[model samples]
Target: MEFGLVLQTDPPAAGVVALMRRAERLGFSHGWTFDSVVLWQEPFVIHSQILAATERLVVGPMVTNPGTRAWEVTASTFATLNEMFGNRTICGIGRGDSAQRVAGRRPHGLASLGRAIDAIRDLAEGREAVVDGTPLRLGWVRDGRLPVWMAAYGPKALALAGRSADGFILQLADVDVTEWMVRAVRKAAADAGRDPARITVCVAAPGYVTADDSPAALAHAREQCRWFGGMVGNHVADLVARYGTDPALVPPELTAYVEGRRGYDYTHHGRADNPEVAFVPDGIVDRFCLIGPPAAHVAKLRRLRAAGVDQFALYAMHDARESVVEEYGAHVIPAFARP
Candidate 1:
């Protein structure tokens, strides 16, 4: 399976570029960043620097929303990059999240997301598509290509990812949830007459490599990565609202922890000490993140691969960002390297 590094485009544009360069040298195939314009810097602009710095790192937004920019503009931006560089660009998109909510807008629906994906893919690939009731196409694009991957957590979103997106991005690393979502996406693909195996399954989560397996070390690891469960709870809360608290529709493994989730604050959206996420217990943090020795990381990743994960992207949201990347390159990555 391929490995990726996810970032938040936190300032010092140069630092972001350096991280991607290091990640590429360390064998990470993809470099993703948060696309929330207000919360972070513009990822598309940063993608240019990342691509220019790295030899083969595929850079894109961990997820950009359709509501933030016009579909035509989004397609053109990606197509422009593909033109300058090779077709080493990916578009991982979602309806909308902190990017929208922080800007005083509600997240969009699947219908809008589906429409944007079609338009972006078509336009970037040199085909014609209709956007905002007007037929549009990137006239300058010739052999330009952009693969649209959708970040999803809900039933309908998963179905949409299966039927439309070239890849499916699941933002947590829990085994049961990963298996269920992967199966859901693939099954949707089959039911939609699409080849299930063709869709890429990317499981993204925070990963931290530790010194030992002792309870104290494990506790520290969980504390650093606990923010992930809360980040995920934001989406789970939405799922509950949409699909109700039915464990049959959405696994309790996902919904159960969020029961104590009183509310969320975008100020601490994806940070390590998100106080709003206090409800996220140690168990949820352990399951949702990969925090252990290299061997342990390799073991869990192997299980995820067996369950049909095409790639495992590190959220890189904690303090051990460089350490995690280096350790994965030195040990975890080679452990799973295909011969």
Candidate 2:
């Protein structure tokens, strides 16, 4: 399986560039960032720096929403980057989340997201597409290529990803949930008369490598990565509201932990010490994140790969950012290397 590194585009843009450079040197093929512009810097601006600094790292938002920018503008930015960087960029997009909510808006509906995916891909790839009843195309884009990956957590979104998107992005790493979602996407693809094997499945989550399975070590690891459960809960809460905690529709392993979720504070969105995340439990953290030693990570990754995961994007958001990248490069990544 391929490996990718996920980061939030915090300030000191150089630091973000440095980390992407290091990840590329250590064998990460993709570099992703959170695209909530209000909470963080503009990822597309930073993506330019990352693309210029790294030799082969494909970079884009872990997710950008369709609502935040005009579809043509989004396609133009990506096409521009691909023009400069040899098509080394992928667009991982979602309906909306922190990017929209923090700006006092709700996420665009699934219909809009689905249309945005097609319009962006077509325009970026130098094809003409209709956006809002107008024929639009990036006239400058020649031989440009952008693979649009959709991030989805609901049935409609998953079906849209399968029917239209080039790939699927699942933001958590639970093997059971991974298996279930992969099946859903592929089945959707097959039912839509698309080749299921052509779709790439990426499972992204925080990966905190611990020294050992000792009680103290494990606790620290969990604490560092627990924020992920709350981050994911933002989406799960939406699912629960719509799907009504039905296990047949949405797996209980996903919807169960958010029962205690009261509300989320975007101010502490993806931080480890977010006060709002107290509702997130340790069990949820363990299942949602990769929190043990390198061997343990490899074991879970093996299971994930068996479940049709094409890539594992490590969200190095905790204390040991560099070390975890090094550990994965030295231990976890090599375990999956092809001869």
lDDT per residue for candidate 1 within 1-339, as digits (tens), equals 999999998898889899889999988999999999888888899999999998888989889989999888898989999999989999999988899999899999899999999999999999999998999877889898899999999889999999999999999998999999998999999999999999999999999899999999898888889888988998999999889878667978998888899878898989987777779999898888998899999999999999999899998888888888899999988987879
Residue runs of model 2 more than 4 Å from their true location after superposition? none
Query: What is the alpha-carbon lDDT of model 2 when measured against the actual structure?
Result: 0.92
Model 1 whole-model lDDT (C-alpha atoms): 0.91
TM-score of each: 0.98, 0.99
Error of 1 at 292 (Å): 0.8
lDDT of the candidates, in the order given = 0.91, 0.92
Let me know the TM-score candidate 2 reaches against the reference structure.
Answer: 0.99
Q: lDDT per residue, candidate 2, 1-339, as tens digits?
A: 999999988899889899999999998999999999999998999999999998889999989989888999999999999999999999999989999999999998999999999999999999999999999877889899999999998888899999999999999999999898999999999999999999999999999998899999999998898889999999999998998987878988987788899888898888888877778889889888998999999999999999999999999998999999999999999999999
Q: Could you tell me the C-alpha RMSD of candidate 2 in Å?
A: 0.7
Question: Where does candidate 1 stray beyond 4 Å?
Answer: none
